[model samples]
Target: MINNNSVTFIMAGRRQRRRRWLLVTGLLTALACILCCFMLLLGNTIYPVNEVLRALSGEQINGVSFAINTIRLPRMLTGLIAGFAFGIAGNTFQTMLRNPLASPDVIGITAGSSAAAVFCILILHTSGAIVSIASVIAGLITVLLIYIFSRGCTFSIGRLILIGIGIQAMLNALISYLLLVGAQQDIPAALRWLSGSLNGSQMDELPPLAITVLLFAPIVILLGKHLSMLELGEQSAISLGVNTDMTRITLIVSAVCMIALATATTGPIAFVAFLSGPIAKRLVGAGFSNALPAGLVGINLVLGADLIGQFAFDVRYPVGIITGILGAPYLIFLLIRMNRKGDL
Candidate 1:
C-alpha cells in the first residue's frame, strides 16, 4: 500500500512546514528585539542607539544613564519576561485542554493571584516580596482547587472551564469588596497594579520572575513534543507512549509558577496569555511546537501595547487597558465562531 510518490509528497510538505515555522519564529524574535531596543531608546528623551549601548555598558552619559538604567531597562525586562510567561502558560493550557477559553486569565487563575495581591495591598498593607509570595501561593492554591473540583470518575475539560469561570467571578467579587473597604490611599496603588502598568518597575523586583521563567521555560520546551501529543486527547497520548499524567502535571505546574510570578509582577496584563497560543499556532502551522513562538508573540503584544499606551494618546494608558481593548473584540469574535460551530 505504500507508494514512493505519496511518501515524497508527504516529506516535501513536512519540510515546507518546518521552514515556515523557522521563518515565522525568527521574524517574531527579531521583532521582539526591535521592540526591546525601542523601549530603551525612545523614552521621554530619545537617545541614539549608540548612547543607549554606552549607557548599558556603564558609561556616564548624563541623563541617558539614569533613564536607561533606572527606568526603561527594568520596565522592558518586566514586559519581556512577563509576556513570555503569559504566552507560554496560556498556550500550554489551551493546548492541553483543547480549548482557548481554558486560559488562566479566562479561567480565574490570574484573578486568584490578583485577589491575593490586592488583599495583601489593602488588608495587610504589604508590598515587596510579601505580596509576590502571596500571589504565587494563591495561584497554586486556586489551580489546585479547580483541579480537585473538576476531577471525577473521568476528567472533563468542560467542567474544569466552568468551574474556573465560576471561581473567577467569585474572586473578582472579592477584589471589588476589598477595594470598597480599603483605605483610599492604598486604592490608587491597587488600581494601578490591577490595570497592569509597567510604571515604577524596579530592577530588584525582576529577579524572582526572571529566575522562575529561566528555570521553568526549558522544562516546558523540552516537553513540548509531549505537550503536542497531549493535544490528541488522553487516550491518544497514552497510546503514543507519553505519560499523560506526568506531562500534564509538569506543564501545569511550570506554567502556573511562571504565570503567577508574572501576575505578581505586572498584575495580570489582560489577554496576553489568552491570545498568544492561537496566534502562534496559526503562524507556525501544525507540525512544530508553538511554545517558543507563543512566547515571542506575547513579547510583541505586551511591548507593542505598552508603546501604544504610552504615546498613541494624550493620556498614557496602562498596558492592560491597551491589551484589553485589543482582546475584547477577539473574544467576542471567538465566541461567535465557536457558537456557530456548536462548540459553546
Candidate 2:
C-alpha cells in the first residue's frame, strides 16, 4: 500500500497540477492588467500610457488628468470590481450546485436587485446610498424566496433553477410595468441602468463596493475548500463533516451582497456573472480552485466589452448589450445540449 513508486507518482501529479494552476492564474492576471491599462489609455482623446500613469499617481495634466482620474478611472474601477464580484459569486453558485447553468444571472438573483433598483429610481425617487441599500436588500430577499420555494423533500438544483427562472419572469414583468408607468424623465435613466452602463459612474459610488469585495472575497476563498466539498453532494459533504446548511447560507449571503452592489454600481452587466465562471473553468482546468481565476475572467470580460462597446462599434452600445449578445448564444447552445441529454 505504501509503495515508493506510487508515492513518487502521486508527488509528480501534485506538482503538475500546481504548475497548471500557476500558469493559468498568471496568464489571466496578465490579461486583466493589460485590459485595465487599455481601458485607461484608449478613448475619444487617447492619452499616452505615461500620462495615464501620471494621472493615476495624482498628477495634474489637464485633459489627461480629467479623463484618467475622473471619468475613465471610475468606469474602469467599477468594471474591475463588479466583474470580480460577479465572477466569484457566479462561480460559487455553479460550483455549489454542480450545474454550469446555475448562476445568479441565469437564475433570478440579479433580477431581484434590478427590480428593487428600478423601483427605487421610479417610485422612491432615490439616488446614491438609498438605491444601493435597496438593491442589496432586494437581492437577498429574492434569493431567500427562491430557496424557500425550491425547498422540498429532497434538495434539487434543477428545481431551484426552475423556480428562479419563474421568479425572474415575474420580476421582468414588474420591471416592464415600472417602465411603462415611470415618468418620461426617469425612463432614460431607468433604461440605461437596466441596460447596464458605466458611462457616468461617480467615484464616490465605488467605496462601498470596494469595501464589500475586499471583505467577502477572502471569506469566499477561505470557503473554497468547503465549496469544493459541497460538489460531492449534500449527503457526501455531510459525511465529510461539512455543515452543509450553514456553509451554503453564509456563502449565499456574501455572494448576494457583492452581486447586488455590483448591479447597483453597473446595472448587472448582463452575463459577466454567468459567462465568467464557465470560461475560466475551461482555461484553468479542474481539480483546483477556480474562483479567483473566474473573477479575473470577469474583469477581462467587462473591461473588454466596455472597450468594444465604446470604441469598436459606431452605435455605442452599453456594456450589458454587448455582454448579452455574447451570453445569449451560449445559453441557447447549453439549452440545446441539455435537451439532447434530457437534462432540461
Candidate 3:
C-alpha cells in the first residue's frame, strides 16, 4: 500500500511538471509571436500588421517587398540569432559556475573578441570573414588564458572573475588606444562596431551563425542536463558517476564556441548573454532546468530589444546599447540584492 501511494505521488508530480512545462512553453511561444509581429510593424513607414503579413508571404504591399526582404528580414534574423546565442551561452556559464554573474560578457570572452576585432579594424584593415575569425580566436584564447592562469589545486570562481575583469580592463585600454591613433574616418565605424549594431549585418553573415547555433545548441542543451548533477559539487557529481571534468570542459567549450560565433557575427551584443538565463529561470520557476527555456528567452530578448531600439527611442540606437542601458541596472540590482541576502 505504501509503495502504491509513492507511485501515485510520483505520477502526480510528473503531471504537475508537465502542466508547468506546457504553460511556460505556451507563454514563450506567444511572446515570440508577439515579438515577430512587433518586428514587422515597427520600422520606418510603419506597415500595418495585415500589409506586413502580406509582404512576408511574398505578396506585394505598398511597394515595400524589397525593403522588407532585403533589410528588415535580415535585421530581424540577426537579432533573433544574436539574442538566442547570448541568452543560452549566458545561462550555461551561470549554471556551470552556480553564480548569476558568471556570464561570458562578465568573464572577458566578449571583451577579448571585441579587442581583437577592433585591433584588426584599426590596424590590420581586416573585414568580413577575417574579422570573424579573429574574434573567435581572441575569445577562445582569452578563456584558455584565464584557465591556464587560474589552474592550481583546483579552479576558483573568484579567481576566474578577477582575472577576467583584469582582461576586460586591458582590452578596454587597447580599444581606447586604437581610437586615439585611428584615422578620424574609421573612428565612427569602429565605434559603431564596438557599440554592437546590427546595422550592417548582411544575409551572407547569417549562414555561419545559423549553422553554428543549429549544430551546437542541441549539444549544449543535451550537455546542460548534467548541469544540475554537476552543481551538486564536483566531488558529489563524481560520486554519483558523473564524469565531472569531461562534462565541465565540454559544456564550457561548446558554450564558448556558440558565444564566439555569435559575437563574431554581431560584436558580443551586450547583456543578452548575462540577462537571458536568470530571466528564463524566473519565468520557468527556477530550481534546475537546462538550456531550452534560456535559448527561447534569448530569442525573445534580442527581438524585443531590437524592436525597441529601432522604434522606442526618438533616434535609433544599436541593440547593444539598448541592452547595456537596460542590463547594467538590472545587474546592479542583482548585485545589491545578492549582497543584502549575503550571497555576494
TM-score against native, each model = 0.97, 0.97, 0.92
Is candidate 2 or 3 superior in lDDT? 2
Local distance difference test, per candidate?
Answer: 0.94, 0.91, 0.81
lDDT of 2 by residue, 1-344 (tens): 56998999988988898798899889989999999888888888988778888899999998889988889888989999999999999999999999988899889999999999999999889988888899999999999899899999987888999999999999999999999999889999999999989889879999989999999999998998899899889889999999999999999989999999999888978988999889988987767888888889999899889999999867899999999999999999999998899887
Q: Put down candidate 1 lDDT per residue, 114-182, tens digits, no spaces.
A: 999999999999887898789889999999999999998988898899999999999999999999999
lDDT of 3 by residue, 1-344 (tens): 99999999988887777677668867886898788767756666777767777788999755577667777888878878877788888898888888888899988888888888888888887777787778878888998888888777978877787788788888889889999998888889898888877887788988877887888888888876588777677888888888888888888777777888788777767888998888888777644474778888888878887778888779998888888998999989988997899775
RMSD in Å for all candidates: 1.2, 1.2, 2.1
TM-score of 2: 0.97
Candidate 3: segments with Cα more than 4 A from true spot: 48-54, 57-62, 286-288, 341-344
**What lDDT score goes with residue 17 in model 2?**
80
Off by over 4 Å in 1: none
Q: List runs of model 2 lying over 4 Å from the truth.
A: none
